[model samples]
Each structure stands twice: as structure tokens, then as C-alpha cells.
Target: MSSSSAEVLLVRTGAAATLDRTSVGGRGTVASALVKTPRLGAVSVGELGFQGDVQADLEVHGGPAKAVLVYSDEHYDDWVAELGRDLRGTGLGENLRIRGLTERDVCPGDRIAVGSALFRVSAPRRPCYKLALAHGIRDLSARVQRSGRTGFYLAVDRPGEVRAGDRIAIIEHAPHRISAFEVNRVINLDKRDVDGARRVLTAAADLPPRWVAKLRRRVDGAVESDASDTARLYGTD
Candidate 1:
């Protein structure tokens, strides 16, 4: 698939239930699988999420701006090599597994048409301990953060049915032109990049509020401790 026309490789959904493992701190039950089950055919995309999908924790997962989670199939090889295992069943808790698009190629507010639904890139997926728990690798979340391959979230603009093999056609690219990868790099990898943080913060309306707030503090030269915030954002608290 070309950059302009990516294809949905798979569709997945999961129920809201108790996680098989405890939180990273081992203090409480982290009520999320972060592992979606594949769907064989077309599925309805609603304003919040897929028809059968349910987030274990709404505080961090699903919402209007985070209606859907998207990951590229292009990253599978890298992850396979990094993890040294097959990730066929591990959907990374993403709703759509697509091809051709990655963090570097997609930007906040970019619009796309998938099947009959319309979606806009909202923000980058912040790596969390749930990823490590899902993959059985204690450092996977940190590795993902460093790699900048952390996928992205999409806000549903028009609800419709979508399926595997559906072409994802670009509708409108955001004027700001800040790729999700750049935002992740500034926030997670290089907090000292004040200029980059400023650009990201300016696009506040297109990013997650939590990220916008954090970036605001960084750009303002305030000492913002994100360790606890990150943990809370991922519901590992």
C-alpha cells in the first residue's frame, strides 16, 4: 500500500474485564487486558469505539478524542525482532491494525477515511506498563517509549462499518504538520527540546489534554514530574 492509501490489516476488540496479571506495582488488580481479539469481518465504528469493544478503564483509554487505537503492521517485524516472539494474538489492544502509516508519517488532526467511517488523528499512544504486562516483558513499555513506534489514537468523525482490507484514504492533513513521532520525541525522549515542545503545545486542540498540560509545563520551564502522571495516565496507579 502507498502512503496515501493504507490498508487495514486487521480489526480487533476486547471486553472490559480484570487483567490476568496485577498492576506493575503489584498492589492492585489492573482491570485491563490491553490485548484485543481479532475480528473476522466488518465491524461498526461508533463515536466512542467499535461495537463490541470496551475499555477496562475509561479514564485513560476510550473517549471522543481516543475513540480508536491504530497500530501499523509495518512495526510488527521490529517488535517481533525486539521481543523474539510471534505477536499474532497480541493486538496491542489496538482497534485497527493498518499498513503503510507509522508515527513519522501521520500527524495530529490528519483526517482519513476507513471503509465508511471517518477518523482524525488525535494524539500518540503513550506507552504504559500494561504493554509490558500484556507481552510478558517487564521493559517493553520503556523500550516502546524510546523507539517512538508508539502508535496513535483516532477520533471518530463519522461512525460507520469498517473491516480488514479496507483502504485508509487520506482526507485532510493538518495545517500544523506536527507528526505524532515528533511529539513523542519531545515529550518522552527529549524534554529539553523546548522549541519542539512549544510547537506541540500550540497544537493543543489536536492533542490529548493530559499531554497538552504536560507540554505546557515543560515549555514554561516548570519542573513537571511525569513519572507519576504517566503511571496514572495508563491506569497503573
Candidate 2:
């Protein structure tokens, strides 16, 4: 791979290289690639934590049309489930299955070039019970309460088109220290980072200052999300 390129892999919705783009309910066509932006933090499918390409731009009812995409971690532990005795990856309902892009490696404002689709890393996606249920898992909220590998969010920096199997390339932005993983960890804590909250907005154009201050107060100093033993493997905690 070229120094400017990274091997990005995702399961194609179909075997086709290009897809039709539409809203959630609509019959979405396959694309060469997609983009994501952070609206919330922490994405969990079933019982896994992960990062990267957290969401894809969708035509929403009222919103700007960003939705959480689903994908299963390919290289994960397998076990028997109550529904069926089988090996299961992280119990996440990611539209695009991710392999190498650990949550910490990418941050908001970072752009990824998959095939021809230019996606801007918006922020980290938040985990909710809906995700768990979607994947036939239980207590997804609780699992995320313990693990903060929420999916990342993206905004189409330069929307072209995308699909699975396209290679993802990193296009860097300024103040690249904070990553989606770190942002998720710090923001979820009981205490908040007043400064950090504000700093993140710099990367995201839509986020307001009030929200940032609110986050700092939540984290206070202790950066724990689900459990008090909050530690991060991707970005700084």
C-alpha cells in the first residue's frame, strides 16, 4: 500500500461495487464507499467496542441525514449464544464490518478516502439499547455502560460515492491529538473537561459551546463512562 493509503475492508451489502443511496427505510443501493460523522459517542452492536466509519449519511426525516451504520468485528472471540450455538463477533449492528481501524486510531476531522467516497470523521457515535436489540443481543446499554467502543460518526466532507472493499485513506486535519475514542471516554465520565468540550467543537462545525461546557461538567476530573475503572485502549482517557 502507498504511504498515503491504508487497506480498508467492509462487507458489501451486495456483491456490486456501487450502491444506491437512500434513507433507512428506503431500499439503499450499494456504493463504492460511504462517510460518517459523530453525533453521539460509543457504539456497541452486541457486546463489543470499536471505532471508525461509525455512521453513514442518510436522508433523514428532519435531521441532516446521518445514521449509525452496522458492522461486526471480523477478528473477535466467538461463543455459543442462547438463540444459536455459534461464534459471534462483537454484538454490534454495524452496516460496515471493520477490522483494523481501532476506535483510537481515527478522530473527528480526520478524512478517509474509501474508493472514491471522501468521508470526514465527524465524532464518536453513542451506544444505545436499540443497537443491541437490532443484533439479537441483550442489555446492550449495560454492556456499553462498561465498554466505550462506540462507533465513530462521519459527515460527508466531500461526498462522492462509496462501497465496501474500497481502501480507506487518511486525510489529516489540525490539532489531531484528540481521537474519537478519547472523546467518547472523557465525555462519558461523571465529570467533564470544560476545555476539552470546547476544543472538540473546533473539529465539528455544528456542535455548540453550551454542549461542550455541559460535557466538561460531566467528566469533572474522573474520566469514567460505564464503570469507575475507566481506561482507554485507543485514545487518552
Maximum-TM-score candidate: 1
lDDT of 1: 0.81
Q: What is the Å distance of residue 19 in model 2 from its true position?
A: 25
TM-score of 2: 0.55
Question: Global CA lDDT of candidate 2, please?
Answer: 0.44
Task: Quantify how close model 2 is to the true structure by its C-alpha RMSD in Å.
Answer: 11.9
In model 1, which residue pairs have backbone atoms overlapping below 3 Å? none
Please give the CA lDDT of all the candidate structures.
0.81, 0.44
TM-score of each model, paired residue for residue = 0.90, 0.55
Per-residue lDDT of candidate 1, residues 1-237 (tens digit): 456678999899888666534534454556784777889888999899899888887776788888899998878789889878866576577889999888898889999899999999988888777777676666667777889889999999999999999988878988888999998898787888889898887678888777889888887887567676467334443
- In the range 1-237, model 2's lDDT, one tens digit per residue, is 231544434432211133232222224443322222322322222211122332222321012223224232432332233234332333343445555575567766666665455555655665543333333344443445345556665555553444444556677653645777677765664245657655655554433244466565544653435442222211111
